[model samples]
Every structure is written in structure tokens, then in C-alpha cells.
Target: MNDLRIYIHIPFCKQRCSYCDFVTYDDKSYLMHSYFKALDTEIALNRQYIEKSNITSVFFGGGTPSYPDAKFIKAALNKFDLAEDAEVTIEANPGTVDFEKLSIYREAGINRISFGVQSFENDMLIIMGRIHDRSMAIRNIKDAKKAGFDNISIDLMHGYPLQTEEGFRNSLSSVVDLGVTHVSCYSLKVGEDTPLQSMLDKGLLPEIDDEKDRNMYKAAQGYLQANGYIQYEIANFARPGFQCRHNIGYWVLDEYLGFGAGAHSYYNGRRFSNITVLGEYIRSLNELKLPEDYSETIDMEESIKEFMILGLRMTDGISINVFSQKFNRGLYSVYGNEIKDCIDSGLLISNGEKIKLTQNGLDFANKVFRKFI
Candidate 1:
């Protein structure tokens, strides 16, 4: 059987973060029951695809996956006949989960728990409109550990307009103290039309300092690596054997199916996404039709570009032999000039076996990625 991954989007949350632009709603709890029914219909619609593949991983992500009733989450998971070693993960916000709820998820077959603990700073949390304080974040993680979750990951956000270097450092130290298995540190992006963006527009918040942002990013790499976490992807660090398999599947361009409103899929040589509008999604799925709003066939040329681009996101980069084997074309034949340009600029290093980003490349990765396109 072919290897596959599945992603289920839960678009409900207690409160929306100020900087978030994802397609999630805080006032949609009333639609939770209807949405899961539509989600079940969508999964049933894709039953043939699921039957033919051995699903290796599943992820529940969203506004806050833990915000929903555990039964709905468990009911959705029961639909998949996953691999015995499948890595099932849920993206949880700090205040939305408790010991009993976490234990329910564990019993439902979720093996990995990724907490969206954006920061451990009370001021930062308040500014970001996060409902959880530092204490709550810590307690939730301890609760997850106590619930028998050994493979745990936490997300940290830095470079916000009001985030301080010291606060970021302390946040890193706390993760070490918690002894979680994985970490994903990311820089803040002020989404357009978001509350955070409005604050910037009204001069209520200061503009983020680019230099300080770079320093914080570098610090996370340095600090996390020193603390025994391997920087596997550009933004993700993990202890041994604990890398997020579901996300890695996306990076490597594996075939996967997605469910729920606004979820995306790359299956059957097509890239497509469901309707972002919940009503439309539910309506279409109820009619026994797939709720696709946008789709495109990934041709050879587009596939090559995506492979190189996504592969380069990881620290190990892409393999030359695998590229030739998979695409039946030499990597140099397709990206000879682009590769040379990145290497000449000291952004990428190519040993014949593989080509990966250099330390300098990490900072200017967007520039190097542009060369390939």
C-alpha cells in the first residue's frame, strides 16, 4: 500500500489571536456538530482513496483543535484505518485543554500533542490577545505529560512588535525545563487586516525591528541546538526520533488528503482545496459532492519547482540521486544555473550527494528560493 497523510481542520476557537489570519472562527461553536457531520461526509466521499493507502500520519489543526468537544474529535479519528505506527497529532491552545480531555485524545489514538504555546510572557500573551497566561501554558504542558503524552511539541512566536529578547530566551529555557520532545519557533508575521495590523496602522504598536528579529531567530537556533534539539526544518527543532511526521510529509511532497472547510489536499496528481465558507462546504458535502473551490493539476515542471522549493525547507535539503530517480531527470539539468547562483552567493552548499542551505542561507533563504523560480 502507498504511504499517505491526512489533515483534519477544526475551525473553532475560544478567542482569535490578534495576529492570526487563518480561516478559523470563534463564534462558530454552534456549527460544530454540523461541521463534523460534513467532515464525516467528506471523509466518506474519499473512502476509496483512504482504502488504497496506508495512512502514516494524521493532524488535527485549526482555530484551536482542543476547543471542540472531544467526542467530535474522537468520532472523526475513528473513520481512518491508520497505520499501526501512525503519528497522530493535535494542535492545542493552552487554555483549551485539561487532563481529562487530553486523556480522551490519547485514548482516541493521538500519539503526538503539539501545543500552540506562542509565548510564556504574560505581556506578550496579552498583546497577542492570547487567553492563556504563562502559568496556564506551563500547567497545560505538565498536564499533557501527565496524561501519557511522551512526544510533545510546543510552538513559540518571536519578533512581535513588543517581544523582548529576554522574554524569548526565558521562553526557550522553559521548554527545556518542560523537556518536551519537539519545538517549532517562528517569527511573527503581521497579517493584513488583522487586529495586530490595525494596531500598527493606528500607531498603537511599534514597527518590528528587522535586525532584532534576525537576532532572535539566530538566538533560537543557537539556544535550541545547544539544548539538544536538532534543527530539522528551518523553523522546527526536535529531539531524536520525534520529528513531526505529518508536517515532514508536506515538505517532502507526499500524497495526502485533507478534510473540513478550507483544508487543502495534494492527491491524485492534483492540488486542491475545499471551500473556505463553512456553509458552502457543508452544503456541498451534504449533497454527496466533494467541496472543492480551487484546484490545479501539478505538471512535471511545477512538480520539479515544488520539490526543490519544499525540499530546501528542511536542513538536510534534497538528495540529487532521489531527484533524478523520482523525476527521471538530473537535478543539474533542471536547476543547474539556479543552484550555481545560490552556491556562488554563499547561500547553499552542494556536496554531490545532497544540496542544503548554509548557515548564512538560513537568514536569506527567501532570496535563494527566488533563484530557483
Candidate 2:
């Protein structure tokens, strides 16, 4: 049996950003007692999924996991059956973490910390409606290190409304200089129905230029790679042996359970998502029922399509042998024409039976991925 991975969503934030659409709110006064009870019940019901006592990774993502009280976090962690060496990580905002909370989380079995340091520029931080300034983020990093947390990752973003290439580089350099083990850099997307979309429509904010976004991404890749960080995923770079095991579990299509409002889980050929609305989530869970509002069991062709699309996102592409083993079919027999066509088009390369994206393919990754989709 494959080791199970766990994801716990902390669906609260000190404030909501302007360009955000994630299922989180700014209210601090939520039904904490009721929420934890529901979560505990869900955990007990789903504990049977961890066959062979195999639980390898646990990730705490947001709203902002660090935004809550430390005691609440400790209480929540006590419910799970975590492996001794499991890669336990918590997502944190800069100002939300302190030495005391860090100690508490570490004591509670969290060994990794991923900080949301979107930018090191004060102006950009304000533009993004982030609560922490550059100083607070830097201080948090130092304090975390002082608290004996070495395995750390930082999240940064590019292509903000008024961001420049120089400004982006400065942010990257600052984090790199801080000596984090991993970094995840993502390009800004102006999704439909987001506050950013409204701003763009009203001419309050300029539209995101695709070319500029591409340039920034390429620059990030070059700079980070030059600094000895390997690009494991398209948006994630890590020091040797320090890749995010939890996220890699997702990209590799490994089984994981999602617990919290708006969380999604995939296991036993089924994918289900919890309710996105907070009130609805609490209501369903409080009633001692699973909060799965949407679900789909992936089929053969859809599974293959997802395999190709997601596998290409990693620096290590898809393996024909692995595919063959998975489907009990020959790789050439199944994807011979498609593979040959992609290779001829200079979008893919083959190493033995493993197929991966070429540099050009990575640049136009969406197009390459869409071929399979």
C-alpha cells in the first residue's frame, strides 16, 4: 500500500487580499469548538484509509494556518496519526509566526515551514494587500531559524500589477540570501470573478501581460538554478533532497486526504472536494456527515490524460515503463503516434522509456499539456 499523505486546510486569514478568491475569511471569531469536533469525527471516520500505518507527508495550507491561535493548532494536530519521520509542514504568514508559536508547532510534530512571503518590497506588499512588510518577513525567517527550524520554504509571486523585473529579482535574491531550502514561485493569474478582474475591467488596474509574465518566469528559473536550486516542478525549486514531499505526492498522483472546508482529496480512484462555503461546511460536518459537496471517480482515458498533463509539470517527465506497469499495456502501443508526433514537433524528449518536456515545451507548457488534455 502507498503511504497516505494528509492535507489540513486552515480557512481563515487576518484579512482578505484584493485579488483573492480562495475559500477563506477575515473573521477571527468562528465556531472553533464545533469545527474541531467535526474535524475530529472526520479524521476518525477516514483513519481506515491509512493502510499499513503508512502516512508519509502532512501539509497545513491556508487561508493561513499560522493565523490561528497556537493552542488551537496543537489541538488540531493531536487528532491525526502522524508517522515519526513524516514531512509535517505548516503554511505561515510573516507576521503571524513567532518564536512561541514556532516552538509549539515544532513540539506538535511540524518539521517544515513554508512562509508566504509574496514579495520583499513594501510597496508591492501593500499593492497585494498583504499584512506583513519586508522587515517582518525577514524577521520571521531569522526567528524561525533561531527556533531550530532548518527545513523551510518560501512562496513568492511575479507579474503583480505594478511589478518590475528589477523588483522581482530583488525579492528572489533576498529570499535566496536568507538560505531557505525550497522556494515556490508562481505567476499572477487574473481569474474570472476575482477582485483583480473587476479592477482590470474598471481600468483601476492594468491587465496582466502574458509576455511579461513569461519573461519573469524564465528569469526566476535562471537565477534560482544558478544559485544551486533545482527546479523540481515548474514553479518549485529546492536544494538537493529537499523537495516538498507533500506537493510531490500530489504532482505524482499519489493518494492524499483533504480535511477542512474547500479541501479536496483523492484516493481509491475517487476524488472529492469539501464544501467551499464556510457556513455550509461547518453545518454539514456538525451534523456528523462528510462535507463532500462534489466528487468524481476518474476513468481510464481521463486518468491517462491527467497522468500526462500533470507528469509533464515536473522536471522529470512521464515514464513509459511506469505507464506500462500502471495500465498493463505497452507504452508504444498506447501512445506511439502521440509520442512520436510530440517528439517530432520538438516538444518532448525521450530518455530510454521516460518522456519529458524539452526547454521549448516547458516554455509553452500549457500548449504541450493541452495536447494531452
Candidate 3:
């Protein structure tokens, strides 16, 4: 069986965050009945994409996958030929779900829970326009534990407006105290057209300083490392074997099928994305058609460049042996000059067969990535 991963996008949220620009809604509760029907259709239609493949992971990312209830999720559970021990994950928002809801999800086959706990500071949560406060997030964590969730992750954001180093430390410490299996720490990027961007444009928000962001990132790495978590990916830290396999599949450039509005998929060297509108997605799927709004078949050269960039995102880096075996070309011959440039500038280090980013290289990773482009 071909190895593949599955992603289901649940685009409904109780309320949208200020910095979020993802396709999602707050008034879609009434549409849940129809939404599940559409999901059922989409699942059946896309079964061919993962045909003869043992689905290794199933991820429910969102707005908040747990918002519509576990019944909505259970409706589509049996549609795919998932592996017996598939790693099924769902993102939950605090104050929107409780131990009862989490138990229902566990019964419905979700084994991992990622809570969107941006910070442990109530004031910071309010400034970020989050619907739930720090106490609510803590409550949800405790509830998930009571509900028998062992693989729980927390989504943390740093470098928010007016956020200090001490505040970031406190946030990380809280998660460490709770003994979360995984933690994804990301800096606040005010995406275009987001409410946070608008506030910044109007001088109502302070700019997130780059130095502060870097400091917090480094601090998180140190804190998590001390707490027995490994920084396996750029922004993700995990305890032992608890790294998010679903996301790891993406970084490793493995084939995966995506369903629902605004979800993107990559299979057979082609990339496709569904329409961002929920109604449009359902309408298209209702017509027995895939809701692919845009797609691209990556060319050879572009594929090689992408392979290098994506592989470098992981701490294990890229293996020269694997590159040669897969592409039948010497790694040094293909991008010898680029590799030499990066190594000479202390952005990349090579240990004969494998290459990885240095500490300084990680700080300026974007610049290094651009070199391949």
C-alpha cells in the first residue's frame, strides 16, 4: 500500500482570532447538518486519491474541529481505509470544549488534541482578541487529561504586541508544568487583511520586534529542551516520540490528501487547493466534483529546489545519500555553488554525508532558503 496522510479542514470557529486570516466563520453553527453531508461526499469522492494506500495519519485542523460536536466527526470516520493505529489529531479551542466533548472525540477515534492556547497571560489574550482567557485554556487542558488524552499539544504564540521576554517565559513554563506531550511555538505574524494588521496600520497596535521574537524563540528551545522536549522541527518541540506525525509528513514531502474548504493537497508531484468559501466547497462536492480551486504540477527543477528547502526545515536535515539515490545526481554537482556559499557564510554545516543549518543559520533561515530559489 502506498503511504499517505489525510487532512480534514473544519472551517467553523466559535469566534475568529484577531491575527487569523484563514478561511473560517462564526455563524456556521446552523450549517453543521449540511456541512457533514458535504464532508461525507467529499470523503467518498476523494477515496481514489489515497487508493491502495495505508493512511498513516488523519489531521483535523481548523478554525476548531471540535466546535460542531463529535457526531459531526464520527459521520466521516469510516469513509477512509485508515490504518488500525492511525494518528488522528484534532485542534480544540479552550472554553469551546470540555471533558465531555473531548471524551466524545476520543470515542470517535481522535487520539491527539492540540489546544490553541496562545498564551498564559489573560491580558495578552485579550489584546490578541482571543475569545478564551488563560484560565480557560488551563481548564481545557485539565479537562482533556481527565478525559484520558495522553498525547496533548498546546499552540503557543510569542512576540505579540507589548509582550516581554518574561511574559513569554511564563507562558512556556505553564505548558511545561502541565507536562504537555508537544508544543508548537510560533511568532505572531500579522497576515495581510487580518484585524491585527488593520490595527497596526492605524497605529493602534505596537510592532513585534524581530530581536524580541528571536530571543523568545531561542528561549523556548532552551526551556523545552530542559524539560525533556526535543526541537525536532523549526517551531515544534516534542517529548520523545510525540512529534506531530501529520505535520512531519508535510515537511518530509510525503503525499497527503486534503478535504474541505481552504485545504490544500499534494499528491503525485502536483499541488491543489480547495476554494476558501464553505458554501462553494459544499456546492462543488454536492455536484460530485472535487472542489479544486487552483492546482500546479511541479516541474523537475522546481521539485528539486522544493525538496531541498522542505527537508532543511527539519532538524535531521537532508541526507546526501538519499538525495543521490532519489534523484540520481550528485548533491554537490546540482547545487555545489549554493551549498558552498551557505557553508562559507556559516549558514550551513556539512558533515561529509548530511547537511544541516547552524544556530546562526536557523535565525536567518529565510535568507538561506532564498539562496536555493
Candidate 4:
């Protein structure tokens, strides 16, 4: 059986950011007890999948996995039949983690810590409605190291409404200075009906600069690599062997089981998700029913398209031999025209048995991906 990965959602965020649309709650912390009970029930109910495959990685993602009592996280993690050297990780908010909580997490088997330190600029943190300042973020990294957590990562964002190109570059520089093992840098998207979007519409905030966003992204690619980090994926950079295994399992379309409300799963070509509403999620589990809300069996053509689109997101790109072995089809037989077009346009490079994006392709990645769709 292939390696199975697990994603445990902890939606108890202490506060919500302005440009967020993730299914998490700041006001619903009062329901934490019931939610964890539901999560436990959901995990127990997936015994068949859990037993068959060796769980290689477990990711505790969140509103803030570090915000909740550490005991809750430990209890939930203990349910997994994990491999001995499993790369277990927890996503944390800098202001939410401390030495005590981190110790509990390490004791419970977590080996990696990923902090959500969006920016080094204090004013940008405030604009994004984040609680932690630059100092707190730096302190959290130091404290995690003190807690004996060596494999650490941090999340960063670019393209805020008033963000300058230099500011984003500085954030990247700070990460290199902090000496964390991994970095995931994402461009901010102001969702419709989100507070940030509302502010833009009302002229309360300036618009995000597209040129600056692109420049910042390109800068990180150069700067991080110069500092000895490798760009494994479009948004992720890491020291060699420090890449996020849980996410790589995702990009490769490997089987994964997700627990907790609003969680999604992909296994055996089937994609499914749990009920997103907190109240309803808890109620279903209480009634001894699975909280699965929706599912779909991916068709062959859709699968091929996804394989190409997602594979291209990684810096290593897609492998020809693996694709052929899995699909039993020649690479050029299906998407030869698309591949040739991308290569001709200076957007992709077909080197030996691997196909990947070119330097310019990083700027117009969506265009290359759109060809497959």
C-alpha cells in the first residue's frame, strides 16, 4: 500500500484576518470541547483506511493549531497509526505558541513547527489584523528552538494593499537570517466580501500592486536560493530534505485522510470533504453518523489534467517515466501539443525525462496551467 498522510484541522483561531475565507472561527472557541469530541469520533470512524496504509506524515493545520490547549492536539494525534519516523508538524500563530505548549507537542510526537509570521513590518501586521508583531514572531522562533524543535518553517505573504517591494524583500531576508529550515511564501488574495476587499471597495485601503507582487516573488526565488534554500514548489523553499512531506503527498495526488469539520480527503481517485458548519459537524458525530458532506470520483481526463497542472507547480516538475507507469499512456500522446507550445513560448523546458517550468514561466504560470485545462 502507498504511504498515507493525515491532515487534522484545528479551526479555533483566536482572531480572523482581514483577507481570509478559510472555514475557521474566532467567536466559536466556546465550542472547542464539542468540536474535539467530534474530531475524535471522525478519526475513529476511519479505521479501515488508517489501518491499511502506513501513515507517513501528519499535519495539524488551523485557524491556529497552537492556539488550543496542547492536550487536545496530543490526544487527537495519538489516534493515528503513524510510522516510526513520521514527519509530524503543526501550524502555529507566533502569538499563540509558548515553550510549555511546544514541549507538549514535541512530547506528543510532533517534530516540526510552522509559524504564521506573515510579515516583518509592524504596520503591515496591523493592517492584516494579525496579533503578533515582528518581535513576537522572532521570539517564537527562538522559543521553538529552545523547545528542541529544530525542523522549523515560517509562512510569509506578499501583495498587501500598502506593501512596498522592499518590505516584502526584507521579510524574506529576515527568514534567512532567522535560519529556519523551510519557508512558504504566498501571494495574498483579497476574497470577495472579505474585510480587506470591502475596505478596497470603500476606498478605505489602497489596491494591491500587481507589479510589486511579481517583483517580490522573483526576488525571493533569487535571494533564498543564494542563501542555500531550494525552491521545491512555487510557494515553498527549504533546506535539502526539509521539504514538507505532507504537502508533497498532496501535490503527487497520494491518498490522504483529513479529520475535523471542513476537512477534505483524496483517496483512490475519490475526493471528498466533511461538513463545514461547526454546529452541524458536532451534531452528526454525536448521532453516530459520518460527517462527510460531498464526494466525487475523478474521471480519467480530469485526472490527467490535474496531474499536469499540479506537477508543474513543483520546481522539479513532472516525471515522464512515473506518469507513463501510472497512466499506461505515452506523455506526448495526450498533451504533446500543450507541452510543445509551452516549450516554444519559453514557458517550459523538457529536459530528458522531466518536464518543468522555465524562469519566465514562473511569472505566467497560470497561462501554462490553463493550457492543460
For each candidate in the order shown, give its overall lDDT on alpha carbons: 0.93, 0.86, 0.88, 0.91
Per-candidate TM-score against the hidden true structure: 0.99, 0.96, 0.97, 0.98
- The alpha-carbon root-mean-square deviation between model 3 and the true structure, to one decimal in Å, is 1.2
User: For model 4, how does the per-residue alpha-carbon lDDT over 191-309 read when each residue is reduced to its tens digit?
Assistant: 77889989999999988889888888998899999999999998999999999998988888888899998999998889999998999999999998999999999988888888999
Worst 10 residues of 4 by lDDT: 189-198
**Which of candidates 2 and 3 reaches a greater lDDT?**
3
Tens-place lDDT per residue, model 3, 114-192, is 9999999998998878889888899999999888899999999988989999999999999999989999999887778
Ranking by TM-score: 1, 4, 3, 2
Which residue pairs show collisions in model 2?
none
lDDT of 1 at 132: 96
Q: What lDDT tens digits, residue by residue, belong to model 2 across residues 1-373? A: 5688989888888988777888787874466556656677777767677545578888889889998788877887777677778898999999998998898888888889999998999998998889999999999998888887899999999988878889999998998899999999998765668777788899997777878878889888999999999998889999999999999888778889999888999888888999977777778876878899999998887778778888889989888888988878877787778778889999889988689988888888887776777
lDDT of 1 by residue, 233-254 (tens): 9899999899999999999999
Model 4 stretches with alpha carbons more than 4 Å out: none
Rank order (by lDDT, best first): 1, 4, 3, 2
TM-score of 4: 0.98
Per-residue lDDT value at 97 in model 4? 84
Which residue runs of candidate 3 sit more than 4 Å off their true CA positions?
A: none
